[model samples]
Target: MTNRKIVSPSDMAFSYMGRIDFSKPDSPLFIYAGSMVSTKFTGTSVGMMIFPHLIYKVTWIGVIVDGIQYKFDLNHSDTPVYIPIIDGLDEGEHTVTIYKRTAGSHHYFNFCGLMIDENAEVRPENHEYDMNIEVYGDSVSSGEVVEAVNYCEHTDPAHISQFDNSWFAYSLQLARKLNARINCNAQGGISLINGAGYFDNYIGMETVYKQMGYEPHFELTEWDFSRYTPDYVIIALGQNDANPDPKRIYEKEYREKWKSVYKNMVLDLNEKYGGKARFIVITTVLMHEPTWDDALDEIVNELAMDNVKRFKFRRNGAATPGHPRIPEQTEMADELFGFITGWES
Candidate 1:
């Protein structure tokens, strides 16, 4: 490690993907899954330093070196620690991508910098994505329980974090499938409205969509939406809105109020990201009550915004009793790819 040169996290050589809060002193905070940093280095290895805030659960990182993908676990430490994302390559030019692969609720990491071989030259990666997508979603969008291959279509395994990987989430998969830059503004067990979901304490997307980090115990910075603009804004919420067998959806007052708030959210985002931003409101392939999607349809109809569209996955609302596994996620992604592309065509 002696000969390694440190690239400060604030270095312009890093190409950022997704929503990263850069307001901190030393480094930026990687706030959501699929948020990534990409750079090119002419060296045999590259690593990263991060201060992990592991309060709820352990978080994981995903690295793509010269296009090969793999997972890296963050070091469990109260202070900054170095994790070798990629090493043992021939001494030459190589591209590196480092991303958070789990939701922030599990933990959020403060990026310190990149540890690069002193001899190597670090440069910004030049990548131009034709499409930009921002998704305000719940656990399904966050890729929760996606690694539970053995328990696909069934209840998740007793141990959750160990098997949760956002890399396989349909949202990420769709982005990859379509070669787009995506902001996965998603969380696990999160609802559209506050104080909802099956979890004992569920954080809602309405509360988190504008915040830097979701740690309730800490006062976090509000996200500046001026940073990234999206051609498409997908709202994949509603799965957690009514949990533990609630009658909220059944109540006429609650239903109308929910639609009003939801419609306004779409209107705000449409105007926020430029009035022409196309909005796709949808539910997932999970086995949720159809009323949620029904609500979405009602909003789309009421708004009648030419840019707003409603879509349902081929198996939306009836995919599985458990979280959608990798295959199921991919299934949804495939359909979505066709749907989006076909819509464009």
Candidate 2:
């Protein structure tokens, strides 16, 4: 049978708890948070029309069909690329879900639509969740280099592209445990004040947080805060701000500036979303910077926002050369889950 069937975005169920531009229904924008597409279909093959960004784009997406995971690279493609989902499945109803495994800094993808076996019958499935969460941070939150077997295995950019799995990240893991939809606004080497030393000319999280997409080349689509409100907002930052060296430990001025920026960020978020969501600020897991921890405490106390709280991840051995691996990510997720549940109870 000819596999020439095409399905519109409207025909498939989409569950993304982030800001998406659906102005053009034909090409829905997918940013952070694992945007999911689910449909029950009778087909032997399935495909997707994906438009990747041209620069600063490195997206790792996973297509889960019937519980199996398949990862793909959606980056640097100017035109829409036709991605093969899978072939040779039994002729019956099957479910498929496509989720972003990379963070927002890598950029976003424009999902044009889907194509399947010409004879198959496809219909949307309801995959919505009752609760919503959002996570904002740097590499640790993005699940960067999480799959590296050992420190020696993490060498260069290629390794990051291969091992990074946002699906396994702490934010997503916690969301899954709570049965909540998540929005992940994280990048590999991002900070709030200064850019992480790893990347040259890197933009900080505070600056990029307002823009629609990560890369500068992409058309600016200012995020519409009204799109999806989260019940919980987890801020996993400070590591990048500390970057190559712990500025909070050695530089008093830098420490004060960090505190100021964090205070402003929290206040801004509280002002815009305070009425709807509770805020949880977190410290880095790689390094134990007491000054940074103190700074976070000060921010919370200064804000005195009844809904805001603070948490810290106990330092763990590096998962890779400089990033957290699967085990560390799992621990972080567990800690977060316990904290959130404890508060809710």
Candidate 3:
């Protein structure tokens, strides 16, 4: 018989890569796209103890070993269990990174712990994040429909769990390009204000930003700003603000209220970063109303803070009617990366 070693959430051998709730350090909660847990093992097998989603049966996770990548579903129909990710690796030390490719919109499970062969040696990751970046946006930033490659430049496949993969998200891609730790706070239909967006019940990023993506599907704690403040906060709202909703975009009051709230929201984020970090506000290449972008320009101007600047894409509104695919995500990442590094294309 083989002995088993349980790695609790608080185990030093585990390294967290995103804004995971650590109240129960031994079994932390994961929210948002790109949230991850990483570690290395000396044996051929390792597995995850997960509390699966009750409603959505399709939960996708990106499991990377050394340089190879694989995907798995974590949504179990019953109680939490030890789900083996990869059990047949070479019998030697191996590094593994497991991240949520689907967001709270798709899965709402918190990992319980990790199981490894008792004789195996395990250790935390060695990579150091010289910089930290936080992103707040809607479906585009959440990697929704990114794998719907067949519909590029047109429209997304009807929102399906199979199509969403945060690994291909521009925010995560940008993090990889810049070699930074990221807190990607994104949802599928969130907008800047509380009452406008593709999401039902007016669930906006403004409300979700302060919490750990709390929804009826799961339990989460209020975000402790002291935990993971960033050097830069990237805001990607406004794309869905013009969606047919509780707010009428054509009205002057609607535009005025939007700009006001938008400015205040940035100010709130600036304060969260201790008023020293910068805010790079932007919209995506996904086709949208000129009014939303126009209002953003006004908001950035009104803020008048040197650290808060709006970065525009060369092909912003000229890209596609559907959610951006992997190619467009890379294109956007290139432009944003260039802007951040102060490099001219």
Candidate 4:
């Protein structure tokens, strides 16, 4: 491993994996690499830290840690990438890369700079994939936009009052903090299960993830999970499930069925990855009623076990009238960040 080769479509490089090309006004919000080494090998537990580069104008940005992805606000005009050198990575050498779904163009840009603890005692560099982070839910997770003129376009609507890269929603904020490479399977108007039940011709969670681009690279499903099994899965669903009408279609039998559906989904994922990873099931930010929180809690508590530790049910407080605004999402992220890394607020 003497000859180190670095490739960049953009002329940017650095040493010690610390900071590089960060001086650019509108540079990629995150840059780094990750390893699957165990904490025993390195004295630190690995994680990613994000600094918004702009004076708080980076509306969107993300990073892939191990394999489980995380996102954060692109608000700050400038900030540096923070990849925690943790001790849970497997004993070996792994490559960690960061990704950005450019806010305006909606294009995916993948880059690398961060590296895991190389100073560890047992330097076993032979693992293919280290970790995987999967985000599942409705619109927000799917990279959806309710106000955009078309489905293909992504824009913060005019009605949005509080606009700050730092004020961006919580999902993106937490993603950056975790330094996780992510697959955002959320779509606006989506639900715990298939949103098709709500919107006659709406996109579904699994379908969206499946339909993601694979032009030069193979789809996520086609990729080998052996390189890395999804270590963290954050399911932020149930926003649309808060329909006031008990007679709504997704209600009635759907309520009872949702628990089973959600439980089975987690079980299936656990089964797929051999129960070696972790799952975090989240409730809505602000639903129609508080009872929905109670129901979601019941489902997660009843179903999650073993490697899958369920965090307490979370809900955002009040915000602007129309939708779940950025402020609300920030509050939600505050809670979620604490849960994921066990970090104090």
Clashes of each: 0, 1, 3, 68
lDDT of all predictions = 0.82, 0.72, 0.81, 0.44
Candidate 1 similarity to native, TM-score: 0.95
Q: Give the top-scoring candidate (lDDT).
A: 1
Better of 2 and 4 by TM-score: 2
RMSD of 4: 12.5
Question: Tens digit of lDDT per residue, candidate 4, span 1-345?
Answer: 112222222322211111122233233322211111121123233343344333213344544445554555544323345444334556554434344333211222233323334353322223334334766665444333322322212234563212212213455556556665444444445555554435324434443333333222222223233433566877776667544344443455767876776777777777777887778866544434545556667776787475555555354422323344444555666777778777222
Root-mean-square deviation of every model: 1.7, 3.0, 2.2, 12.5
Better of 2 and 3 by TM-score: 3
3 or 4, which is superior by TM-score? 3
Q: For model 2, where is the 10-residue window of minimal lDDT?
A: 151-160
| lDDT tens digits by residue: candidate 2, 172-273 | 788888888877787777777755434336677777677666654456567777676789998877766656676444677876777787777777776777
* Candidate 1 positional error at 226, Å: 1.4
Candidate 3 whole-model C-alpha lDDT, 0 to 1: 0.81
Error of 2 at 323 (Å): 1.3
Query: How close is every model to the real structure, measured as TM-score?
Result: 0.95, 0.87, 0.94, 0.50
The sequence of per-residue lDDT tens digits that candidate 3 reaches over residues 45-96 is 8777886664466667777888787887665656767777777778888988
In candidate 1, which residue ranges exceed 4 Å CA deviation?
198-201
